[model samples]
Target: MLPEAKYRFLSEDVKRRSGLVLGPEKGYLVESRLAPLARTEGLASVEAVIDLMMRGDKRLCEAAAEALATHETFFFRDKTPFDLFSEVIAPALKPSRAGRAMKIWCAAASSGQEPYSLAMLIDEMSGLRADILATDLSGKVLEKARAGLYTQFEVQRGLSIQRLVKHFDQAGENWQIKPELRAKVRFEVGNLLDDFSRYGRQDVIFCRNVLIYFSVEEKAKILARLAGMLADDGYLVLGAAETVVGLTDALKPAPGQRGLYVKADSGASAPVVFRSATAAA
Candidate 1:
């Protein structure tokens, strides 16, 4: 078990670097998440890993923070958001971008499923030229995503057999997405805490299931930046568990839809207030 002091320091460090707010009660999480990294480094305990991190081991510290990231994802996770993309967003954007390519950003794309899923949908659409960019905080996950390979269990999660056979080929026990499908999207390492201005105006942004880890203020800040990056009619999809209601008015729930958020009338941000991650729980 980590001492309360060490745990607090770790939680704050994680917040500073990654915007993930691990409150004091998450000591067990820090211990468990860093254990494998500890063993890999031949350190005796997670405490030793933290001690080195506190001592200014920059590389190890970033890896430890990356370790805390929740990479739990599967193809077409939660269903509705992808449906909204294909059924609503895509059809709406096709006309406006009749000659140009549509830009889609999967901001927190954990292991590529989200962006790859988007790619597959785009493949099915006729006369729609789209560019997909998927990014994550961990370089390790981006490597896996770039490879476009998934285990049987991973493919089975949300992929139907028809889509699976259509998009992937058996590589031993794993399935690799077809080369053409893989080429449709680009994967990169990105941090939501950094400036997002370089991405330009995106037609759609999928940042689902990511903001719940941040404190209220951090979530608000991220949403405000995302709003600026969004096209006038662009949609932002968050996890079903997350909402922009109390955080920022820069975004509002899309009418008659569940997880999609669109810009508010003023297209401006409201003030953010400090809210503890623990209290949010």
Candidate 2:
């Protein structure tokens, strides 16, 4: 067990820099995430790792950041959000823009699963012109996303047997994503707490399950930046349990959809008034 002082130090460091709150229940997560780095550095424990990490050493700091950012994600882990994307979000793109192409951003795309899942949905739409921009804080996962490979179990989670057989080809014990789907997604490095100017305009943003790691202030800041990238009519989709209430009024709850938010019109300065555009039309 990490000493109380050590835990407080590490937790405070993480919270200060990344806004990731580390409570007592998540100590094991810290140990597991940082153990590999400690091992590589010939350190004996998480305490020693923390000592080295806090010394203003850029390299150690980066390693610690990567460890904290590494997380688990599976293909179509939650079907409802993707279903919302397909049925509500995707269809809402202007008809005149059908062949003009649409942009989808998957923030914190771990190992490519979520973005690839979005690609699958896009492919299912016979005539929609869409592409996926998947980004992560870790370069390691971004490379994996670019490679489009996954272990059998990684591919299986949240993916039905039919999707598995249809979208992935077996390579020994691993499954490789089909080229057609892989071709539609482009992966790059991104910091959710930093500027997203490189991402260009987006019609849909999938920032699922990421904000829970951030402090409330950080969540609000991220929502503001994300909302800026959205077109006036674009949508933001967060994790099922996450919400933008009290974070930003720029995003209004998308009517009849549980986890969807639409960007409020420019020049507006209040908590978004929830109105169903579909109903209004």
Candidate 3:
């Protein structure tokens, strides 16, 4: 595979900005997403593309970051977590919502599907309410998320036919999510590594499938920050393949679940040490 010398500096910038580590394997992805953009602007090659990026053009910087990050996502991409979100997490947190409204954040929401799926689940439940803040590092994906458009394959992967009919309408050959459902979601461009001072506290955060790209050190930093963002009784949801092993002690596996972790109570915030590498058991 070719080293991404063309966008190395910008790639480093993305790592600094978002904590998403992109190595050589991602060179094709950058070339693929940005080559056309470069050609359209009459630039010669990927080196020229990086040159434009280094010049501090905000649009190029944003575009280059979007190019390197993966945006492939679907509604309820993995069903078990959503099941856990609805069945266990929400009910546990429901009683805590006496007079205050609940807030759920999708920290790495890609193209809005995960968060929208969450909103749809809430919509299905009567009076069990919450607000959703879906954020991604790439404004391009967030814009697509706000648009609520989906190709047939994108809609069918995890979205059930019944829910599909209820929440989407056919627009020519594509599906468009209903305004009522789409309106419930709020999309923003956010980097999980940065101080989330503006995002406030949350009851649940779905940061699934985004951590695999980070170094273990980066993952630890991101997890520590997420631990702070959770309210006393909040939970953090990670991808099935992701783990909190070296991250922090504030999270422990939800009882009877393999990939889920709940925030430990106030006194339990100390770092969890292990005697063995197999400590996850």
Candidate 4:
């Protein structure tokens, strides 16, 4: 176990770099997350990892942050948002972008599932041309996403058997996303704490489930940046548990939609409104 002081310091360090808050109760998490890294670096213990990190070992500190920052995500996670994308957002956004390619940004894309799922949906549309840019804080996960490979359990989660057979090729016990689907999306390492202006405005932004880790102040700041990066009529999809309420004035709930948000100035009207329905379990 890491000493109380060292655990506090490590917690603060993680927040400084990644905006993930870890309280004293998370000491076990800290120890478990960093123990393997310590071993891989030939350090004797988690305390040794912390010692080097506190001593200005940039690499060790980053490794610790990445380990702690990793989170679980599955394909088509929280079906409501994807359902809204397919049933409402896509059909509505298509006409406005008749001649140009629509851009979608999967912010906080852990591994590849979320963005790849979007790619599959877009490919199914007859006249829609779309590009998906998926970003994550951890380079390790981004590499895995770029490889487009998944174990059996990964493919089984939320992936319909027909979709799986259509989009993936078997490789031993794992499945690799088809080359066409893989080619439609690009993966990069991005930190929400940093500037995102360079990615250009996106037609749809999926920043789901990631904001719950941040403080309210950080959430507002991140939402402001997202608002700036969205097109006038673009859609924003957050996790089912997340919302724009009380966070920032830059976004408002899309009327009748459960997990969808829109830029506040986008002139949302009754014609686009639809009542919320329960997401598939």
Candidate 5:
């Protein structure tokens, strides 16, 4: 167990660097996540790792932050959102924008599943040209994402047999995304708390399942920043469990889509009704 003073410092340091709020009860998580780093760095214990961090070791601090940040993800997570994207968003975008390419940003794209899924959907559309930018705070996971490799179990979780055969090629026991699909996404290491002006205006932003770790104030700050980066007609998709309600007025829920929000100034249009084929099952 980490000493309380060290725990508090580490927690505060993580929040300062990454905006992830580690509560008192998360001491176990801290120990579990950092202990391996401690072992690898030849430190006596997690406390020793913390001491090294306190002494101004920037590398250890960054590794600690990466260790604690959640990277949980799977392909087409919560299928309804992808369905809505393919059915409503894609068709609406193609005609509306004429010849311009659509830009989609997956702000917390852990290991590439989310953005790759978006890429696949975009590839299926006849006339829509889309670019996908997938970003994460951890360079380690970003590296993994760029490689486009996954275990059988990971691929099985959210991918159908058709998509599996169509997009991935066998690489020993693991599956690697085919070169054509892999080429569609660009991965970068980014911190959501930092300025997003580099990403410019996005047509759609998927910052899903990431806000739950943050304090309400941080959530508001991130959402407001996202709002600033969003185009007037852009859509922002949050996790099913998350919402902009009572958090920030910068975004309002889309008229008929769950987990979808539009900029407050975007103006209301006829609601797009999405009925997922698999929802009945």
Candidate 6:
């Protein structure tokens, strides 16, 4: 168990750096997540790791905070959101911007699965084109995402056998995403706490599942920033359990869409985008 002061410092430092709220009850998580980092740094114990951090070792402190980030993801996690993307959003773009590619940002794309799943869905959309920019806070996970390699267990989690065969090539005991599919996503290291306006406006922002770690105020701040960068007609996809209802006024939910949000006063009716200009009219 970590000493109370050390625990408080660690939690506060992590929240300051990553906006992740690690409550006092999450001590087990801190210990587990920091153990490998501790071992790598040749620390005698997790306490020693905290000791170095308390002394303000910048590099170690950064690594320790990053180590606590949750990267749990799989291909097409929570299928319905991707379904809405393909069925509603894809067809919606066909009429107004049929030939032009749309921009999609996977704001917390861990290890590439969600972005790759969307890339595959884009391919299935007849005559549709899109660019995917997937970002995460962890360089270690981004490296794995860039490689697009997955073990059998990893591939099996959310991928159907047909999708597995169609999109991945066998690599001994593992599977690698096809080069074409791999080219569809560009992965980068991004911290939600940092400025990212350089990536510019996006038509679809998949900032799913990561916001639950933040306080309500922090969630509102992040959503407001995201709203600033979202095209008026664009969609902001959150995890099913997440909602902007009490957090921010900048966004309103897409009626009947479980995790979709859009800009307030968006052209998309009731914040649910139409399939074509005619449909909107």
TM-scores, all models, native as reference:
0.71, 0.70, 0.70, 0.73, 0.72, 0.72
Task: Give me the overall lDDT of model 3.
Answer: 0.80
lDDT of 3 by residue, 1-281 (tens): 33356456866888876667877676655665566567767888777877777777777777666555646678888799899988888788787785666899999988889988998998887666788999999897888899998767678789889999999989865799999999988998988778886899888888898899998888988888888888877888899999887677767666677677777654454356566788687
Give the alpha carbon lDDT tens digit for every residue of 1-281 in model 6.
Answer: 88899999998888998888999898777876787678789989899998888998989878987878756688899899999998777776567666677999999998999999999998876787888999999888999899998867679988999999899999876789999999989999998878889999899999998999888878889999999999888889999999989888889998788888888877737545566667655
Residue range 162-250, candidate 1, lDDT tens digits? 99989999998678999999998998788999987887899899998889888888999999999889998888888899888988877
lDDT of each: 0.86, 0.82, 0.80, 0.88, 0.87, 0.87
The C-alpha local distance difference test score for the whole of candidate 6 amounts to 0.87
Q: In model 4, where do residues sit more than 4 Å from their true spots?
A: 1-70, 268-281
RMSD of 2: 8.3
Tens-digit lDDT track of model 5 for 40-118: 7998989999999999999999999987885657899999889989877777667877788899999999899999999
For lDDT, candidate 4 versus 6, the one ahead is 4
Cα-based lDDT at residue 274, candidate 2: 86
Highest lDDT scorer: 4
Worst 10 residues of 3 by lDDT: 264-273
Better of 1 and 4 by lDDT: 4
lDDT of 5 at 66: 83
Error of 4 at 274 (Å): 24
Model 4 Cα shift for residue 102 (angstroms): 0.6
lDDT of candidate 3 at residue 66, scale 0 to 100: 58
Model 6 is weakest, by summed lDDT over 10 consecutive residues, at 268-277
Please name the candidate that would achieve the greatest TM-score relative to the true structure. 4
Model 3 stretches with alpha carbons more than 4 Å out: 1-70, 266-281
TM-score of 1: 0.71
Residue pairs in collision within model 3: none
